[model samples]
Target: MAVTCCSVCAIQQLVSPYSAELSNGMQMAFLFALFTSAFCREAAKECRRRKKEYIKCLESRVAVLEVQNKKLIEELETLKDICSSKTD
Candidate 1:
């Protein structure tokens, strides 16, 4: 009857808008997830690159210090020989 028809119309109006809103929300969520994943990947790559550079710098510094220590030992030995000769 007229009551049935009115109820059907009301249901259609409410359901249609809700369906469209749900579809739009899903699309936005998908886009956000995609962008966030990309950002995280790029950040990880940058961190690895910086870590490699830091390791290289540290190795070079250690090599220089080792060279300096060897030169100091040689100089100390020469000074010791000179002092011993003077004492004799």
Candidate 2:
């Protein structure tokens, strides 16, 4: 199989010689452990990056909503004042 990334290439290099000395089952187990740990490390890094982006997006959205809310409240107060004057 083609090496997809630096991590895969590193794993293959690290395991090739050691794997040659092991039984088939041991080779599979060793490969699985190495690959799983690498994948977990990559996934966590990706999650953290995406989480930062999501937080920035949410903060911008909140800022916009706050502005809209303030405008709506002003409109509401104007309407209330008009209604009270008409009733009086």
Candidate 3:
């Protein structure tokens, strides 16, 4: 199949108007994708920061509970020894 100059020119004439409109639509789509990617990056950064803070908070809570547990066990042992001595 061979397309000559006349057919090429006729095709361009028919398509030129729609080609400009298509170019503008593609430009708009590119800008929208850029903005969406930036927004998602910032959101991911914030999520990472919040997760770090939450882990630190839980670590501190675990330390506090461990101390409380040791204190209660010591007090229970003291009471048991006192009761046994008084009975003897």
Off by more than 4 A, model 2: 1-8, 16-21
Q: TM per model? A: 0.65, 0.71, 0.70
Q: Candidate 1, clashing residue pairs?
A: none
How high is the lDDT of residue 51 in model 2? 100
Ranking by lDDT: 2, 3, 1
Off by over 4 Å in 3: 1-22
lDDT, candidate 1, 1-88, per-residue tens: 1235755465456456556556767655654565556567878988999999999999999999999999999999999999999999
CA error at residue 1 for candidate 3, angstroms: 55
Judging by lDDT against the true structure, name the best candidate. Answer: 2
Better of 2 and 3 by TM-score: 2
Worst 10 residues of 1 by lDDT: 1-10
Best by TM-score: 2
Q: Write the per-residue lDDT of candidate 3 for residues 1-88, one digit (tens) a residue.
A: 2445874565556556666666767655654565566668878999999999999999999999999999999999999999999999
Error of 3 at 70 (Å): 0.8
Candidate 3, lDDT over the whole model: 0.76
Worst-scoring 10-residue span by lDDT in model 2: 1-10
